[model samples]
Target: MILDILMTFGSARKNEDDCQFNGYLEDYLQLLDNREEHLQVLFQKVVEKYPNARICVGLRFAINKEVVSNQIIGYKDAFKLEGKALIRSL
Candidate 1:
């Protein structure tokens, strides 16, 4: 959905003169930040069920509380994840 929205704007005739679309993208990112707490809770639950499984969380570091690093699968920089609520075996 987001990619479609972005792509549509990129192809617009006045795309080079547009800033509204960029603002929309920032709003979308802000909404993601608002859900960070809820996502962190879900992440904890999954870690509990699979203690031995490798997991990685994603974040923008400087953008504190902006979003949970919820990309546990198919993520490359797993070690760069700095914060953790828990990592011990169950």
Candidate 2:
């Protein structure tokens, strides 16, 4: 089976409070899982929470110990596509 992972990273907005930012991150972390359903949920949540945040998503997979990876920046740009299409494009 091919395992897919979603990694989210970003900085808090200037006017944002640290507690709030940390809470958001904690929520994001809790939402992570190695399933398409979780990924779709994450996509929607991130879009709603961090519309202008600079987010990067990295995808990695291994084939015979050889790892292949790709990363995309800009939350809006990456999320423009839905579900599997987003993963494919990234």
The local lDDT score (0 to 100) that residue 71 gets in candidate 1 is 62
Q: What local lDDT score does residue 39 receive in model 1, on the 0 to 100 scale?
A: 54
Backbone clashes for every candidate come to 1, 0
TM per candidate: 0.22, 0.22
After TM-score superposition, what is the CA distance of residue 73 in candidate 1 from its true location, in Å? 28
TM-score of candidate 2 relative to the true fold: 0.22
| lDDT of candidate model 2 versus the reference | 0.38
lDDT of 1 by residue, 1-90 (tens): 654453433211244422222333223333345548675566456556755333211211222343546564434354456644222232
Candidate 2 lDDT over residue span 1-90, tens digit each: 111112221214334222112223334454466675666576667767875433333322222212323332334354345433322124
Model 1 gets an lDDT of: 0.38
